[model samples]
Target: MSIRKRLSPEESRTAALEAARALLIETGPQSVTLKAVAGRIGRTHANLLHHFGSASGLQKALAKDLASSICAKIADAVIASRSGIGTPRDVVDLTFDAFDKEGAGALASWMLLSGNEDALDPIVDAIHDLVVELNEFGSEHLRDSTLALTLMALGDALLGGPLSASLELPRTAARDRAEAMLLGSIDQAGTLAPEG
Candidate 1:
């Protein structure tokens, strides 16, 4: 005696992806299955399969979505930092939070371990595109800084808590180091810039 609400295909897909992301953040990457997403969205497994082709397809779509969303925010933060409206720590926190609180790190590692190595393409491509787009900022060390920041964020997401505890350091030790590195890179870049 229940009526199902009708949704367009795009709406359905978006809903499924949102549900999958929620599952990723709430439960972990291992819980982001087609069935679970479908259930979360009140759709059938066949519906999700139709939209995504398979579980791997769903994961790839989710990864692409997460990358696009996170990169856009990071890009905004980078722009703010360049305009002196934000600090390097803002960028560092966003990057680290994307990996940790947003579940990108866990999802990426799970995809790799599950043999869906190509699922990482979206993440890599997004980072590459972000760097390229931001290259107009004119920092020769931007790429290096990005690499260091991303690796540090990912590593911290994976082990910073336990490692920091074991080392008797604050939980934010890695984030602090990342902020320092970014600030140093910016200073060095400024010093090397040609005089106007």
Candidate 2:
């Protein structure tokens, strides 16, 4: 009888990572474990060690993946707007939506496991890059990018809060409020503009 060869180290880690992400999204991050991740990917505990030196290592990789994915989505949403019509509001909405239960669970894990602000540095840099890409503001609008990031973070925090447990009505209401506030700010700024 021919014996089936086991997956290589890289393949095992890749599978484990993918499975961890899926489980994190579907069930919750608490569902993740060496045994569970291995089983989900049809591998054994020994196989997981080949990829991640330890549970902490796996957690670090997962945190990195979550940060990358979240920042990418936020960046795309920011860059997609050309109308400038409530763009900040759109960003607020999209950012909060990105923090759905799955994302929230992952974020919770990041806070508990990593808990280091340095771990969030990459994500902050990514948002800064996103701002530079989406904005064409001169010296006068210098503060706009900063403002946008702050407000967007606030919105993300709110939506990630326990008060935002429901995904449907609460999210819609928050988006609507954000849209109104953003539009109001834009309109007020336009009124204060000096005539050409």
Best by lDDT: 1
The segments of candidate 2 whose C-alpha lies over 4 angstroms from its true place after superposition are: 1-10, 83-90, 104-106, 109-125, 132-171, 180-196
The TM-score leader among the candidates is 1
TM-score result, candidate 1: 0.97
TM-score of each: 0.97, 0.63
lDDT agreement of model 2 with the native = 0.59
Query: Model 2 reaches what TM-score against the true structure?
Result: 0.63
Q: What is the C-alpha lDDT of each candidate?
A: 0.94, 0.59
Give the Å shift of residue 169 in candidate 2.
8.7
Considering summed lDDT, which 10 consecutive residues are worst modelled in model 1? 134-143
